[model samples]
Target: MADLQDDPDTALIAVGGLDDPGPSPDKAPKTRPESGAQTLEQARELLAAHPIADGYSGVAQALRESVLYDLEAGEGLLETDIPRLRDGGVGAQFWSLHVPLELTGDRAVAASLEQLDLVRSLVESWPEGLRLALGADDLADARNCGRIACVLGPVAGPALGDSLGTLRAYYALGVRSVTIAGTRWTQRTGLTPFGHQVVREMNRLGMLVDLSGCTPETMRRTLVVTNAPAVISHHPTPVPDDVLRQLRANGGVCMVACTESSIREAADRLDHVRTTAGPQSTALTGAYDTGTPHAPGLGDVSCFPRLISELLTRGWSEPDIAALTWSNVARVLRDADFVARATKSRRPPSVARLLPPLDA
Candidate 1:
């Protein structure tokens, strides 16, 4: 299978989940009080104070253009106004059927199905330049057609209803990738002491495993156990931390996005990665975290372009940059039949070729 080469200039930086409204001025305060009630009230006050833009603005649009980006399902759609996010510069996207664990139960599966229907409805409404992407073929088709292809994924594994059967079912429904958790731990395997089984099943099923939002320990454990190469989709390394060692150790890769604040840290991490992994490891720009506690700025996405250019100036090869930005991710996508054909091939018929072109 031909690997998607990493190209920082055209890399797909994974953004918010199905409900994220992009980088909003309405993001809750970075700091919260110890008291739960006070924190809730403070968030409310912030929400009241600065209403985030509902769709794309020039700043957001410019930011979207800066990074070849993809919106993960949890942030929801960018609404019709942010066509720039879908087409202007940002390329492919992934829609998530992300349901928080609290939302599951006897009614949970039904609710998720309903959410999936809503996603379909939204995709159906997209203009010709935007498309719902399923796998590599779909993404390639979109790029060929000059449209942004959208894939399906999730932010939390427990959102799968704690069932490998459900995971398989979602894969059949077009969910090609799944992240273990966000900041908090969950029942999803590879995320906590409780996640081992889930991790095992995800590998066996060939669904792409994302470890972006997991804690360091959980991430390390997931790396130790997973047989498939994974993606650290978003999130940067703490300065001097060698994330590449963790990734390359397991045949995995990292997409390190740089925001204004995170750029220094990203550079620091890259330097450390070079020091630890040598000058020839893979790395790329991630989301635009410009040091704000909450990550939602349009300028955030553009920050990495210059950082990456600077790296090239410092003797990094284009192929190396490409591996970090695109090929590494392409490797993960290849695991899904959409990007590259499956090796084992015979899955229950329902799981066969789950990713179909939305516009088809």
Candidate 2:
């Protein structure tokens, strides 16, 4: 296998959580705060109303809404729209299996699994044009065929049962990666007595140990102990100083979360790690609906392009962007033979570190 971290051309952008619908996925779609991304009407109105901001809220909101309305509407949220946007330039996404704690009786793992099953059914039932991809090849194939490739994973870790056996099952079912814990500790994996055990098991099973939702201690311990390259699926960059050090020491991967946090914030985090880990560091943009945040005056959808463009101006490059947006993530999933086989040969050709040119 090629040394992925050394690959110069391809990088992966791991988007967290495509599994559970929003807190109110079924709620009737609305204009403003009702939807994180904008509707066509909202986008048109926003452009007519004022100038787009240079931050995350405005542009992302507009772009997401534009993608959905322009490409996806009746096909449902997870159908054609997301891939279209990625093809349009959003990058690979992690189809999250998120279950609200309230609705799941705190059985997040089981709920997550059920949601995964739901995704499976949807993909299985996909019309002739759509399919669910589990590896780098699947994404490569999709990209080659002018289709969007997605990885089936989680936004939070609580969704996996407490036992290593359950984690193993997830891997067995083509779940190539996972975030360790989401928001809190759970009986099976994170922030508890067995946290170390879970990390060890994940390493043993070759599953990526995601520290996206873990506490500092949990993140610290996981980075220090794990043997393989673990991931922080959806987290702010520059990780806390200690975590960065731990990640460097452990030779793990740190995926940037592009959630509510700004690109500057994410960039700063990435820079911090790069200072220590060298230029090989990779990060992902948060895919959660940050287009329209809860904060007042920050929900506009006209700001994403400029915000992202400005990040490029500031020092981030296209390949860097590609790493965060596509290649880095592709590398991770491609590493998994199971996902590769499942997704067919769509995965990118092997390489070392993220670079700009590829035969694909």
Estimate the TM-score for candidate 1. Answer: 0.59
lDDT of each: 0.46, 0.46
Task: Kindly give the number of clashing pairs for every candidate.
Answer: 29, 43
| Tens-digit per-residue lDDT, 1-360, candidate 2 | 222231112232122211211121122222223332323234333322221111111212233334434323334332235433432344345565555556432376666676667656555543343456765567767656644444566534555544556667787776756776643333323345355556545544546667765677667655555545566666543468766656644444566444444545545665555555433335444444432232222122223333334344444443344444455455554333432232233333222221222552
- Candidate 1: tens digits of C-alpha lDDT, residues 1-360: 222322212322221111111222123333435654553344333322221111101222222333333332213223322333422234454444555456644355666566666555555655465566665566656666766555665534555655566777877787767777642234233344335555545655667777766667666667665555666655444422544566555555554444334444556655555555433234443332222231222243322344443444344443444444433444455443432233234323233122223664
Alpha-carbon deviation at 81 in model 2, angstroms:
2.7
**Model 2 stretches astray by more than 4 angstroms:** 1-71, 74-80, 83-88, 103-106, 125-130, 182-193, 236-238, 260-277, 290-307, 334-360
TM-score of each: 0.59, 0.60
Best by TM-score: 2
